[model samples]
Target: MAFVALSEAEKVYIVHGVQEDLRMDGRGCEDYRCVEVETDVVSNTSGSARVKLGHTDILVGVKAEMGTPKLEKPNEGYLEFFVDCSANAAPEFEGRGGDDLGTEIANTLYRIFNNKSSIDLKSLCINPREHCWILYVDVLLLECGGNLFDAISIAVKAALFNTRIPRVRVLEDEEGLKDIELSDDPYDCIQLSVENVPCIVTLCKIGYRHVVDATLQEEACSLASLLVSVTSKGVVTCMRKAGKGSLDPESIFEMMEVRLVLGRCLDLAGSAGCLLPPWSHCGNSPH
Candidate 1:
């Protein structure tokens, strides 16, 4: 994660703001920064999206390729995640320095969709145990402001929703040989149902209250943070803890209350013809 150094007095100022449910940027404790989303922004990809939250910029591209299913789950396909933090994104990302953060983010993304229900993996299967479509989700950290996980998550969900995998058919010959056929029509492709795809919401525990989308300054004041992966249906697919500070059961429970807010917000966005996963819901409290 990218970080910014802050003095003792500066930390106290941000902490005081969070405790009063007012942040330096005028957002509430549970409010997120205004997020900008752009979809289908890249060529030669099955799907692509760019998300900007505060100073954070993330670009995600999903590529669909045919490969054999895994041995453990022969009838289902899987998603592969790769994260790249360019040197220009942050000073700490120079050369191989950002490898650790990239690997950590990629691993977290894997845990987010490590189940069958997250995606219809069965739909990608052309022949049971023989072949399936593998989705390669590549993430590029164009810039690092704060709340890296949340920004990347939103970009990934948007890309997955935009993915269009070519439909394939199996042709079995008389000699018990099977061949795969691809659709000639460009538009003859299948899209994954993103209704169950999860989005990550990072809440930083600052002072006595928790704040969503904590900027670098706010992060310097935070004692701990929670990463919540929630679906549009309010399901928690994964949870992760960050920072050296420890959180009690009460704090964890309080943070979990935020899980539903993201789901409801997404529902409203869909109804309003918005394709992006807007993480903030104004006038809502997570208490």
Candidate 2:
């Protein structure tokens, strides 16, 4: 997360605005900033996407690589998440400075998608305990204003939506050795079902109110925040409290209510309209 220095008076002003349901940017407490999403941004990757939320920019690429299946889940494939906080986002993120934050964000992503309901891993398997497709989702942070988690999660989901894995066949010879062959036709691929993929929504608690998709300035005024990941059907897959301030039980519940509504809205909006392919309008590329 990028740091923003705010004076006491400036913090009070922002907090007052939130209390009145009019944030600094004129959005309601539950409103989000303008978001731009583009799919297949990187040509070499199996899937890629770029998402800009406010001034925060993120690029996500997913590469499907063949690997042996895990012993515990031999019939299923898996997702590996890696987040790189580039120095371009902030000078403080240079070299090893941003490693801790990147690790934290990556762990959060893992927790959010740590369920069978989120993805059909079995569909990625070629043979039980033998071979499977491993999707390596890599996130690159280009800029940071605020709402880093939300933007990254959105970008990841969009990248997954755009991903296509080549169809492969396993053949056994007379010696009982199996050989894998990739499909010759590029169009002959499998697309992952992203309907159940969850998007994260982070709510920043300011004064007596909480705001969604807060700006960098607004974040400086907030003492605590909540992160909630919800599926398209409004099912919360993971929830966690972040920041230094502690919230009472009642406040926690209140935040959960707000998270539910905002999460559902995000899911519907993202899945229904925001994630359209880049060439859908220009008719230049095949979807």
Candidate 3:
């Protein structure tokens, strides 16, 4: 998250606004800022997407490469997530300054997709214990306003929705040597099922209430926050408490309830509504 310095009076003003359910941007406590999603932005990658949530901008690219399957999951392929905080987004992220934040965001992404229900990994297997498709999902932070996790997760899901892996077949000769052949037609490809994909919702605790999609100024007034990963069906796959402050048990439960509603709304908005631009809305959009 990008740092913003606020004075004591500014913090109090923001905190008071949150308590009254009226944010500085005129949004309610649970309302999100305008989100814009565009897919297939990078031509070279298998799939790519760029998402803008208020001032925070993120771009995600997924490249499918051939690799040997893991020993433990020989029949299934895997997804890898990496986050790069470009210095262009913030000068403070120049050099190695952003590595820690990038690693932390990447790890959180891994945890959110660790479950089998999130993606059909077995479909990526080219050959049992021999070859498989490794989807390297790379996220680049172009800007930061607030709610980094939620924006990144949305971009990732959109990129995965746009991903198309070249179909391949395994052939064995009489000598038992194996060879892989890619589909001749470029249009003949495999698309992953993002139906069960989960989106992240970060709820920041400000004053006696919690808010979603907090801007940098509002984030400065927050003490602790909760990160919740929820699927389209409103099932929570993972939850974590973030920040350096303590949350009471009652507040934790209250945040969980809010997470479910907001998560479902996000899922529905991305799937059925106009999350993607009107021109880009096609059969390939997430459903």
Candidate 4:
């Protein structure tokens, strides 16, 4: 996140505003900052999406490769999450310095997707124990405004929605050797159901109140923040805290209430059906 200097009076004003359930942007406590989502933006990847929440920008690319199924889940395929905090986001993240934060974010994603309900892993299996499609979800951090976890989560969800797993056919000979064939038509593919995918909402505690979709400057003034992942149907998937300070149980519960309200709006707004650009024609491209 960029370091913006804020005077003591400005900080006090923000704190007072939050305590009264309002923000500088004129949004209520549960309102999220504007989010821009674009899918299939990168041609090099099988699936790609870019999401800009407030000023936090994140891009996700998914590549599918044939691999053996895991021993524990032979009948199911798996997803590998990789997050890269590039220097474009911050100079401090230039090399191995960002690896730790990237790993932490990736691990959190893995944990969020641990349940079978999140994705249909079995559909990715080709031959049960022999071959399966391993989905590599790579998240690239382009910018960090304030709520990084929320932005990345939205990008991941959009990328997964845009993912198209190529149709493959398996042939077994008399010798039991398996041959895999890709579909001739590139359009013949399967799209994942993103309805169950969750979006994260981070609530930062300021003064005696909490605010959603906080800006980088607001985040700097916050003591602690709650990260909540909520699906479209109002189901809470995972929860965590990312900050140097601790939060009281009462504040945590209060944050959850705001998270639920914000999650529903995001879930509806971020849905595939809602993302079809109104003015964009099917065959139109900006010159």
Model number with the top TM-score: 3
lDDT of 1: 0.83
lDDT of 1 by residue, 29-123 (tens): 87766667777889999999888878999999999999999999999888999999988888988989899999999999989888888889999
Runs of candidate 3 with Cα error greater than 4 angstroms are: 269-287
> Residue 152 of candidate 3: its Cα lDDT?
91
The TM-score that candidate 2 achieves is 0.93
Q: Mind giving the per-residue lDDT tens digits that candidate 3 earns over 1-287?
A: 67899999999999999999888988778778777888889999999989888899999999999998999999999998889999988788999879999999999989988989999999999998999999999999999899999989888988898899999988999999999999989899998888888999999999899988899999889889999999978999998988899899999998888777667656654443237333123212111
When 3 and 4 are scored with lDDT, the better candidate is 3
Name the candidate, 1 or 3, with the larger lDDT value: 3
What alpha-carbon RMSD in Å does predicted model 3 have with respect to the real structure?
Answer: 4.2
**TM-score ranking, best first:** 3, 1, 2, 4
Error of 1 at 214 (Å): 0.8
Q: Scored by Cα lDDT, where does model 4 land?
A: 0.81
Our tally of clashes for model 1 stands at 0
Candidate 3 worst ten-residue window by lDDT: 278-287
Residue 227, model 2, lDDT: 90
- Considering TM-score, which of the candidate structures 3 and 4 is the better prediction for this target? 3
RMSD of 1: 2.4
User: Which of the two candidates, 1 or 2, achieves a greater lDDT against the reference?
Assistant: 2
Query: Global lDDT of each model?
Result: 0.83, 0.85, 0.86, 0.81
Worst 10 residues of 2 by lDDT: 278-287
Over 1-287, each residue of candidate 4 has an lDDT whose tens digit, in order, gives 44568999999988888778677877666566667788888887778889887778888999989899999999999999999998888777887878988988998899889998888899999898989999999999898888888778878888888888899999989998889999989899988888888888888888888877789878878978888989978899999888889999998887777776667666654556234232122212111
Residue pairs clashing in model 3 are none
lDDT of 4 at 85: 91
